[model samples]
Target chain A: MNEYTFPIVFGVFIGVVTRLYLLKTDYRQYPTYLHGKIIHIALGFIAAGLGTIAVPAIMEKEFAAITFLALAASQFRDVRNMERNTLNELDQYELVPRGKPYIEGIAIVFEGRNYLVIFASFVSTLAYLVWNIWAGVIASIIGLLVARKFMSGSRLKDIVDIEYVEPHFEGAGLYVDNIYIMNIGLPARQKEILRYGMGFILKPKNFNARSTIANLGQRQAILHDISTALGVYRDSGTPALVPLAKRDLDDGRVGIFILPQEKDIEKAKTIIGNVPTLENAIRMPTKSEANKKGRKLR
Target chain B: MTHEKLILAVITTNSNKIAGGAPIFTCDTREEMESVATNLEAILDGIAHSLSDELLIIVKH
Candidate 1:
């Protein structure tokens, strides 16, 4: 109803949206239930709005400090608890092809990052124009930084440091995989644990990183003897089966990863851009414990 | 501990087991180390995905 209420509510709303936006935009490489985080942030806004009104009436000078502390404390408690909740179980292993025939796409219009910038500024000020837009601007930065911090960067880091398997056999059948070409890398400080093959089970269309493991225990005719009996057969002029170039991320830039199909080994050699081997791969020196400024792999 | 440190410690230990030797990453070159790292990470991920309970147990440190 009052002037303070408008800005306070506006600020809180902005803060929540910004938090959600970063989580959505930057978290392409990793997984954290985005839906739940949106809910968490929206509730944070409602809490901020209510606190803005209630705090000023009770304690004017210290209202900002009190509200901020309360938010930090309460948020830490709830999120920490949520993080601690151990995994209960997993669904049955359902098989689905890439982009597993789902309804087109989910649609949500973005109001852009500018609105988020303004809204976050307002919440920190707590319904007051006591400081100029300078304060609001600072608050906006702080809000965005804090929100990203809340998310962490572990997932982003790990995704960048990818692994490739050269067509190895395993037990869970044959799984052709590649990382989902979403936005890559960490957004500031968001940490995530990304599961390639397993997550594929959850997301039908999610193109996962290729696997080197397969479950084909059935060993065919002795390939080694074939290689030995002939005593190193000359390279057959016939072309091997080629892997389809899948452009899932839409950046026009195809992704990189290791594959497990040895049959296509020859084709893959041509299809893959830069397949690093033991000879060419950059063997980064392992960081010593004393070195704090280490180059992060992920 | 740092993220890489935590991950590397487990990976090195596992690679050591696989190689039946010391923690040399079972790799002779940079390329091999990278490949080995990738497989090791996948192994860790597969473990996590298939056995979250076990991952939690192993990651207790």
Candidate 2:
């Protein structure tokens, strides 16, 4: 019945729509089940309600209500924990586990997207209350653009050059390029590995990229992503048929060895190229003070 | 008390080379050693790594 009622409704609607837009289940296949989608949608609705009420609360001089935003922050943090716990539990049985870093990265994204929904709601509500419905629509559009910008991080192809290399063995040792992967004792197992395995070498583009790709977590993420995209040719009690990534000590190149069911090199390369560079795994060594000084000296 | 990486068993053609803590199965021929190693690998769920032609150790990771 109040003037703020329509604005609040509009804000919440925009926020939920924004959340729906962002909650896409791509090749990652996360939140793919109906129950998972329902859980996220419920959380998104709560975030929208919190965001929408803040505008009127501010206008009514109920500044105390603003403190609820702090409550929302903590609430979203729990969403991150929930995601982490669920993913960690499921990771145990995976053919190729997503690793800690990839799980953490996914959890962080779920929390961050909630905040983006809040921002979209707040902006649109403020616009609707102050100006008009058209202005609120425009504001929500701008909000969505900002959210899209924040959603995507750098991909593997941005920082590395990927080249396919057929895995070869020297005696018992299996190698991808010059990188030593592992040793296979059994001739039959070695033959199986050679038949099913595919290898790729990732060369870092710069000094910063060198350290990033060298991270064990980042390397594991690459392996997990590739395994998930293309089916893994591994089973329980078959440890010999596992995928591995080894780094070259001399150069900052990484060698990837995978046992995928599908032997499509082009498809696998595209999947690797699209793998998101984990935010936690990114190391900006060149930006460091000591490194900057050394660069100046040279 | 718990070992993350431990040698589960040893399959070798040469008995003189290894005198160790883990269970050892000495075979007469290279083919016999390989078969034993493969069986132990399946039973113990560990990887069989050959140190030499005569020695193969199954280690759990």
Candidate 3:
């Protein structure tokens, strides 16, 4: 019917579709409930609506309408906080808890996705206003693809070599491919560890990858994900049962040990490969002059 | 503290260092600490201790 109405509705629809596509749980099955999905969809719709209306508002010379974007920004920030809190609460009951860094990363992604949806809608609407409905539809499709690409962060497998190793003990201390995991005191617990424990060695591709895996939070997140995917061995008040990740001091290799209910190495490797490299954990060795000097000498 | 009741003796290299809010006893050598722990082990009934490598955390429950 109306020129503005068609573009606005079409833009909003594309934006919502993009958001839903990004929300699909591939590895980390979180926010899978109907209520969680509904809330996200509703938020995405609002974001798309706001972005779609901005084109018409600007065309009509209503500058004050731009302020609503700032409002949306704050709303999105609150959504991030809500997500962080919910994940934190859920983490307490987990056998292996997703560390603070991972939780923060996930929350930030959720907030950023909303902004992407808004951008998609805004671009498509603007294109429609300039040309026609066909151009708007084409632009919206491109925007969706771009948003999808931007949302995907590099996984652990991209930077490191993950291989399953056997868990062994040297006296009281547990060793996984020369990396000293921890000490297992009781023989009974040691038996269970040998029987059920899955060991993995992550060999970093470069110095930067080395530093990233070395981060305590990143290692904890890996352990959390692996344990979450393959059920963790439930042992109350037993510190020995706790999953551990130890690094090889000589090389930048990391060893992870987890006693899961199911001893499936493939599933464990897949989970490790899917672990999102935490934003804070990424350490660039090239930034430091000492590292540069040392590399030249080597 | 609950750890105080659980920990029989924390024979660390550094006496001043406190662990888990439990009292720390300084021992000059590993051999000396092992002897002391052995003596304590005999005296204390049914109290099994864990000797950790990192800090030699001798935890008993």
Candidate 4:
């Protein structure tokens, strides 16, 4: 049995591991500080290089070699520090632009100093790899994980210009949708209640002023869903529930007048045809003994 | 006020030539919703525009 057989196996494993690391994780997109750790790497390589000549000059050949070895070891230690510093900095959001880390990760393996450390560690170790080799793999996995956490699943800009284009129609008909998404689970005691902006528009099919007012009152109870769907304005800290942002009408239509309940009714009067008050008005959901899932307008 | 009034406003946009009669009334208050039918006076200026055949009726009541 070869004593070195186990070591050889371990060596191959480390080599494969280090090579695999270079293959993955593009570090080019990482922030300047992260990639800037090139300073530590450069210093490490410079020391490694200078040690080759300087250590031989300082003492006997064997002693010089040992000194160079020690220097090389310290340089590796510094490289590990730099790697770790880079990892720590990259842990947060927007730490880097995004794509840089993905691009430069492979290049790290090709560098002469990292390559030297990777091979030597494999050659010398019977079992354990150099600490940074293990750390490098760990740091890479962590970086990848951290990067994914910062990346957004969807962009808000894509959903912005929402157009609900409908088929063209003539005569008088109406299309209405509420302002906000209904969240029923909301506790009533909470001051911030869900507001649904109600929307209603009229097309003059056969303009009968009298029947329209009477019928509108009758339909009040059913319009609870429409009212609840109205959107609330989040202006001046208080949410104003405004249903209609805009309106359009054809010629041949005439509005009677507006009947305002309060002072600010003028704003509303100008927007819709004058106000017409029905006998029964809209009311929110009342306090009930039973658990009420249904609406209040009814 | 404990009994705060719930209001509703409806706006209509129509072309000038097509619009006729009194302007409809819409309100900031839900209670005044029915008052609009009684008013025969065309409060709104007829939307007698230059070219468009659409009429507008901004109703608040």
Candidate 5:
């Protein structure tokens, strides 16, 4: 086997395999169609080729070929914007909308993943060129493990304690674990809520988690994910049935109320637990002087 | 607070006519009506807005 050709092919194969493995996650369940999968996989193959070809180009003293990396960077950024646009358009029709923060987070993750694939292929090819094919295989495994670790970010459950709570209405006001949510006007609607609704209390484990949960965008993401996974019970123009998340000012705990069609509490909890914490929604209390003084800021 | 009567507010963009049996505020733009409705909803009970029908409703109970 020729050194250059075999290493390049193996590197590309490993890179594409790693990319496909990472794409098998459950969060951000969009672009599920066969066409969408094909597009991403094709892009991953291109990224792998770019990385694997760089080693041969450099070995041949063709330094100008490195410019292709810059092109790939810009192309991936376009991928980010495309993801943001598609998700934003889809958000309009969602019963529990994934807010802007969640969409931005998803877009950034997708862009970063392409770069990871490139890195994996580049490292694998370099190891093969230096030593042997066996060494390249080991390098590929290590590269994939690192990429997989980077892919799994902190979830809401990692930072906060999520517990199922009883949903009840005190007079006309809805309450979840003593935190007041919204008010229900119609008795029939209230009856429906009591019958089919599930409630949860998100108790922040620490200051960092508290501020994160306090973010309206973060709470909306949590509600959207759970509602989407468990199936929300609202149609267009039905405002009362929309999922709501309200924070208790006295404490940092947040209350969530959702009317899901399936009413599967276990599935809802699992979905909520798996929601990736939005990057923009994380607020560090110690970073600001006002927060250091224990002044609560939402 | 328990014995007090609930207050309700209705904000609508439809200037043609106000619905019967309730005092409602009319605004030229949907933004203004939504602001009024949201503020009322926060203080009182709840708010519901319909974009297609052009209605901003505030309910208190």
Candidate 6:
């Protein structure tokens, strides 16, 4: 009945729609269940309500309401912590565990999306109050496009060249390209490995990418992603059958060894290329002060 | 002190090569050595690493 009623409802609706668009349960299978989605949607709704009311609060000279954003920041931070704890707990039992860095990256994304929701709601509401519904719709669309741009980070393909290599046995040592993977003594076990195992070498595109791909957590994330997508051919008791990534010290290339049940080289390569380059694992060595001074560190 | 990697057992055709530390299983031939190492690897849930043609050690990683 008030001037703010339609605008508030419109803002909240747009915010919730943006949240739903972002909360996709992709191949990562996070928030896969109905219950998990419910929890996030509920939190998103709260964020939208908070954002929509702020414009009216400001117009009424109730500047005190702006302080509620600080509270929302803390609330979203808790969502990050909750995600981290849950993923960490579940990781232990996973066939190919998502490493700490990958889990942290996912948690950060969950928290960040809520802030995007708030931004979308606030902008849309402000437009509605200032002009009309058409302005509000246009503002919401722009907000959504900005949200989409911020959501996606670089993929593995952007930084490295992935080439398939057949794993070979040099004496008893298993090697992917030139990088030594591990040793297998039993002839039967070695036979089984040769039959099932596949290898790929990741060549870093730049000096900055070398350190990033060499990160143990990043390497683990690669293994986890590929294994989840292609189905790992391994069991608990078989330690020798596990997938591994080893770095070549001479050239900064990484050797990845995996045992996938479905031996489709092209499909596996596509999966590896699609893996998100973790935020925590990114190291910008070229951007450092010493490097910027023209000293060739690499 | 606890070790991250421990050699749980050793199976070798040449018994003179290794003596102390981990429990050693001496085999008469290469076939005997391979079978013994394989069994130990499965039983102990450790990886069997070959030192040479005649020697294998099952180590927990």
TM-score of each: 0.33, 0.98, 0.83, 0.21, 0.81, 0.96
Expressed as tens digits, the lDDT of each residue in A212-292 for candidate 1 is: 111010000111111222222122221011111222233222222221223333333332212111111112333435332
- lDDT assessment of candidate 3: 0.82
How does model 1 score by TM-score? Answer: 0.33
- Provide the DockQ value for model 2: 0.83
Per-residue accuracy of model 3 over B1-61 as CA lDDT, tens digit each = 3444465556565555555665566678766655565455445422323365323444553
What DockQ class does candidate 6 belong to?
A: medium
Clashes of each: 24, 0, 0, 92, 0, 0
Better of 1 and 6 by lDDT: 6
Stretches of candidate 3 above 4 Å error?
A: A288-298, B1-49, B52-61
Q: What does candidate 2's lDDT look like per residue over A125-163, in tens digits? A: 999999999999999999899989999899999999999
- Per-model TM-score of chain B: 0.36, 0.95, 0.55, 0.20, 0.63, 0.92
- Candidate 2 docking class: high
* lDDT per residue as tens, model 6, A198-228: 9999999998999999999999999999999
What is the lDDT, from 0 to 100, of the residue A206 in candidate 4? 27
- Per-prediction CA RMSD (Å): 19.6, 1.4, 6.3, 24.2, 8.5, 1.4
lDDT for model 2, please: 0.93
**Candidate 4 lDDT, tens digit per residue, A1-298?**
4533444344444444333333333323222454454553444344334333332233333554445555556655655555545544453332111122322321232343444434433333422233424553454345334333432222211211112222111222212322221111112201222122223333333223223322333223112112222212323212211222222333222222111122133333233332222222222223343425444322
Look at candidate 2 and give me any clashing residue pairs: none
lDDT of 2 by residue, B1-61 (tens): 9998999999999999899799999999999999998888888899999898999999998
DockQ of each model vs. true complex: 0.02, 0.83, 0.10, 0.03, 0.06, 0.77
- Candidate 5 lDDT at A205 equals 87
List the candidates ranked by TM-score, beginning with the highest.
2, 6, 3, 5, 1, 4
